[model samples]
Target: MTGYERYLPILLLVGSNIFMTFAWYGHLKYRSAPILTVIVVSWGIAFFEYILMVPANRIGATVYSAPQLKGMQEVITLLVFAGFSTWYLDQPLKWNHWAGFALIIVAAWLIFLE
Candidate 1:
């Protein structure tokens, strides 16, 4: 597969995560939905998450070892969560947020190391 194809999973992973963040946290903004509805809605959105995640792992399998795929997924999740929290949720990013994300970014860089 091409390099882009290999990274397609990563892209979908981000998209899924963004949707997931919305499904879960967006409720704070939209409280009309009952708790049960929220849970069901999140689950519904999460279904697409597996769709992307499975393909991501499969395609990444050829280019990356299992450990790498898992590690990449973790890092991508955190980064996506950060952006989704700040932008979509309209949450102000505090110092703690930066510090936490910085650490995660450092960890991501370390994982990229052979």
Candidate 2:
């Protein structure tokens, strides 16, 4: 695969994670909204998440194993979530959270090892 094709999954994953993060956590800003309304709205956002996620997996599978794809996705999710939580939610991550995220990155590195 060309470099662009090889990295397509990562790009798609970034987009997917952005949507997923909002779908799963964006409602915190509107806590006063009705639960049913948030649920429906979250589902609507998640539809776009799946739209990017499914193709990322399908294309990535050609170059990466399922486990590698999952590991990549998890790492991407954490990175995206951290940014969202800090900037959007106004929540700072604690030291332990950074440490835990570092450990997950190590685990992701291990997944790439042959």
Candidate 3:
């Protein structure tokens, strides 16, 4: 595959994860919002995530295995959520959070091993 094809999925996954992180937790900032309102808005946001995620998996499969994709997905989610937690929600991540994420990153690396 060309370099574009190989890397596009990673980019897509990153974008999708951003949407997903917001969808899942953005509502926390607006606690007074009705639950039904939050759920509907979250679902709307998640629709965009699925749009990117489905194609990402389809294309990433060309160069990466299923386990590798899942590993990457989890790592990406953590990274995105970390930033979102701090920047969007004004919540600081503690040392243990970084340590846990580091361990997950190590696991993701293992998934890439032959």
Q: Per-prediction count of colliding residue pairs?
A: 0, 0, 0
What is the alpha-carbon lDDT of model 2 when measured against the actual structure? 0.96
How good is model 3 by TM-score?
A: 0.97
- Residues forming the 10-long window of minimal summed lDDT in candidate 2: 1-10
Query: lDDT by residue for model 3 over 35-67, one digit each (tens)?
Result: 999999999999999999999999999999999
Q: At residue 92, give the lDDT of candidate 1.
A: 71
Report RMSD (Å) for each prediction in the order shown: 2.0, 0.8, 0.7
What candidate 1 gets wrong by more than 4 Å, as runs, is none
- For model 2, name the residue pairs that clash: none
* Model 2 bad stretches (over 4 Å): none
Clashing pairs in 3: none
Residue-by-residue lDDT tens digits, candidate 2, 1-114: 877657999999999999999999999999999999999999999999999999999999999999999999999999999999999999989999999999999999899999
